[model samples]
Target chain A: MNAMTDRIAGVLVLPQPYVLFLGDTTVPGFAKTAFGLRDWAADKCVGELRLPGATVTTGLEALTAAEAHARGARALVIGVANLGGVIPANWRASLVEALEAGLDLIAGMHMRLADIPELAEAAHRLGRQLIDVRVPPPQIPVGTGRKRSGKRLLTVGTDCALGKKYTALALARAFERRGIDSDFRASGQTGIMIAGGGIAMDAVVSDFEAGAAELLSPDAAPGHWDIIEGQGALTHPAYAAVSLGLLHGSQPDVFVVCHEPGRTEMLGTAGYKLTSVEEIVELTLLLGRRTNPAIRCGGFAFNTSALGEAAATELMARESARLGLPVADPVRGGPAFDVLVDSCLA
Target chain B: MNAMTDRIAGVLVLPQPYVLFLGDTTVPGFAKTAFGLRDWAADKCVGELRLPGATVTTGLEALTAAEAHARGARALVIGVANLGGVIPANWRASLVEALEAGLDLIAGMHMRLADIPELAEAAHRLGRQLIDVRVPPPQIPVGTGRKRSGKRLLTVGTDCALGKKYTALALARAFERRGIDSDFRASGQTGIMIAGGGIAMDAVVSDFEAGAAELLSPDAAPGHWDIIEGQGALTHPAYAAVSLGLLHGSQPDVFVVCHEPGRTEMLGTAGYKLTSVEEIVELTLLLGRRTNPAIRCGGFAFNTSALGEAAATELMARESARLGLPVADPVRGGPAFDVLVDSCLA
Candidate 1:
């Protein structure tokens, strides 16, 4: 049995929830899964999870997610893209433990945890909720290959870990603050969990990847903005297919090109330089215009975390003037969005 | 019941076989399937085919592929990518008729005709044969991400109808004539039936699309060329995924870019001008080198069918000189093969 030793790092400003993880993340084989859970669930996580040989960090105790609520834990997350997405039999007992504790189960894997008969029965009996992150929403309409009403924007990044999701969220919030109707549409596991109703694009089959996106970004009311969380970069080799699918599927009316201020190399390629902002915008329009010739790149959403406040602000201003579009660090502050809205949105 | 009427249009130089077409291909709905049969089976077909409303064309009779064989027909072809790849139940009777005549059935759809129990049992009882064109061979190994021996080539086109398959076949035949040990790897329906042993690349699921290519072009014997037939153009919107998958999966050592002489836009896109032969080469190499940096575009393979013989030859020569590589219309005879071999085939 794996137990946790708690060490609280700082005084919690917001009430942090505990989450019981369901993988033996201490082992090298499952470490990546454990790390991913830690990174993605950093916000709510307060206690350790129930898994064999799990290493508990952040001074959180390990308990089943069901029982974690008693210790301030809110959701049980099974974080892993396992082979065939199956949960081994040995893990079933712990799931039952979580269920008995009435923990909400959040499964980010392709395998639907709710499909397990025993777990489903136990959850039902205990009145526990089970969220399958990868299951696509039903009633996704087929793409009409025609322009629709309102404006949609996708946060496309130069590389993974460049904060496309953060920008999308920031933009959605900004639109709301500005008295505009807006929605944040997630396309990945983290985004799905955050939005509470979106498909994990990576887990979807290729044929339906686009279909799922289409479902997520259904036609919005006039003057509303749909800020879609984009998936992989177009330059990524293993992921380019999914990226293109999402682009074609969403048919965004406006585009938000996200990028890191200092990074220069592509993530997966062998020392391949990152495409310039100008080139990426042109490439995106070239492909997007195949479906909607009127589709245009609205502006840049730069992640200026690596730069000082003054430097980031100055750089954003310079680029804004040069590109003649809205350029901003949406999470912090910038001016890239106004021109973008004026150019693409009526 | 469908019947055939024979018409002898001209003196037949080649021994052609009669086939009983299953569906009423002459009708509006099934006409596409019927048309495919006419296209792919042109060389081996005799007078006509058997179908409910099939009309005798060019004085040829209509009969079942099976019954036609009995009357000197060679094979039965299911010539359509039917909805859900299903052969209509009423058509089964015609399949039965073909089985009675001992005709070998060729299925080109995602659905395997042999998988239907009734058809399977009937074929078995009558000792007839069923050929599934889309099934990947068993025991295909996973890609190791390691470089393998043997120089390989793939014919990538500007668009679908630009004769990539035609160029691949021409180059392979040309290599054989040069006493080179090489093989033609098929990746589409027409190429599959022609080779008699290849998977329909487009019908495959996205995950295994690359795996199929890897399986087909396993480490070859020293000094032999693996000329792979490519599917779809990278510039095509709907078809780009399959095309990219083939590119990534095959990991070819050499690129043979194919294009038509006068084609201006992508087949299915809205006013999308074809990227130049030069840019395509650069893009192909950029993507190809993601997996294998040593990968290079050997030269261009132009389909100059629209031009006169003299014009075609002159254009080929000019491009060859301009691109400084072997440029050719292998089907119509050119020097492209020689330069391609010299540049790529060590």
Candidate 2:
């Protein structure tokens, strides 16, 4: 295999049939990976493994590491998405136990699982892999902005952690349901775990962010579509670089602005206000045009988990009317969502 | 010192009063580091060391490793900014000789100097340092976009390797001449070597790029000016992420668009075209406004080396008239350059 293919293969190689380890996480947001795998890649997950004092559950059958391994699970995937993506000192013993249970320890944390001495020693002795999905593949080429054949739809956002990945996932599913050739392209840790393969764009070196994005979605059949999960918003103070790089490299023919209504301030940044959908559409087009001049906004995807059904419906309607674009909560899966899907194909 | 301060200190620690090593490069463009040191940091650079087959001259006294060491040169700074920032296999023997002559080896290459086995062994045996300025300091916090108390001027470019760093350096010098409280902030490898203590923004992880830029030019006295060197252009396919991150983090109050007069295609990329000065100016203002709402374009700095003295002058005047902004070739300092400097202050 060529070097790029080899590196991609190496990065994507993970022991499968996972027992999701949801470490003492009470908040659903913190347990996003466990929940994501349960919802999206349910077939690959054998069961859920919760630590003592854990208050959150993915609703998967609870199983011990040894039990899961006996049931044909090959890996224990760390399913927590903490603030810093760290492996806390309190969780070392539990991780080590999994390694000793004959299951590879898979993590999407910023800190590698092998960096923990106890887990590392146990994994080494037990001949288990410590797969770090968050680590970027080596030697990503600089982006060339060379256009590739195929259709692409990128889910951009006003603030991060809204629903860009979910929108992409839902769109990909919808496209598949319609017998359209489509694939979900992940760009973050949780999404990487869900898709089983993707470059964690944020983890890459700044110089190679676009290149990594390009690698994530390569040339495909002319009728095929790659629905790419986006990173930070164009208005994000810290992460716009990753967002722009993804936008340029993905060269999406259609983009959907994902946003959370009623979010006055941007995530983690107090003084920075969230960008409006109109502003996001304008900026994404202005910047994305450098790579694909034919790029256009397909619609808007609202994360309405915080709103009631009536309120969310009203908001989507208002936004759609004001912006003259289809808007919907993909999870709601109504006629509105159907229109949004049609917009993507259009 | 705190961790941030400690890391910065570690990154900036380099043996000074050096011999600049221009490798077997005949092209002046490839010998930019040698010329930059000879022209800007002349006092710190004691002499030049040229390898066999090198035709480039920095107009400094030529010295061998032993002679340069005897003359109190503490390090041999790699003075070639060659493509890929790599040390050629043929250059290993000459590098090893420098280590043997009791000098620390300093390089601003993509590959670390210590990674070379022969140089590493010699440096270890001689108890000399192998300084790699291309490595970013660890633990850069995510950019908060919290407004700082200093003025900043960033020199943005239409393409890479086209006078952005030189323009920023010249502008910093000009600001100093006017008794303005100012410092030149480096964002790339060569700039880091020249300035001795600035973050290599492009080398930083994509998630921390803006944060690294923020650390490069932190909060200063209200009147202080931090003249930040720009990285890739916003229109650049491969590296716009680095450019946008620096633009947002530096929060420049005034920006100068640096460009070459007649370049059609972008650097390195075959099919990608150059961004117009007007487009650059517009985009710089549009994106730069995220961090600093009052951001404005200062003027333009052109790389007029490809043109004759008269042609360069005529083009500068005509372009200045058309764009209605101060335009000059900073290398060819004249009334136009003085006006350009005035625009920055204004």
- Listed in order, each prediction's TM-score against the native is 0.65, 0.93
Off by more than 4 A, model 1: A1-86, A90-106, A110-132, A135-145, A203-216, A251-346, B1-85, B93-106, B110-148, B196-200, B203-216, B251-346
| Model 1, span A1-346: residue lDDT tens | 0112111211001112437364654444443444444544455565666566555343445665645777666456665445676777877887788767756677767567788999889888877667676555444433333455667888787777787877787777677777888888887766655554466665554444455566667667888788899876665545565666678767887788888878987764446577678877876786677556677887888889889989988898899899878788766754455555555455
Best by TM-score: 2
Error of 1 at A7 (Å): 44
Residue-level lDDT of model 1, residues B234-253, one tens digit each, is: 65655665666677767788
Lowest summed lDDT window (length 10), candidate 2 chain B: B1-10
Backbone collision tally, model 2 = 0
lDDT tens readout by residue for model 2, A146-206: 8999999999999898999999999998999999998899898788778777888898999
Looking at model 2, give its docking quality level: high
- Tell me the DockQ of each model, to 2 decimals: 0.13, 0.80
Q: Candidate 1's error at B127, in angstroms?
A: 14
Off by over 4 Å in 2: A1-13, A24-29, A51-55, A81-85, A88-97, A100-102, A125-127, B1-13, B23-30, B50-57, B64-71, B81-102, B122-127
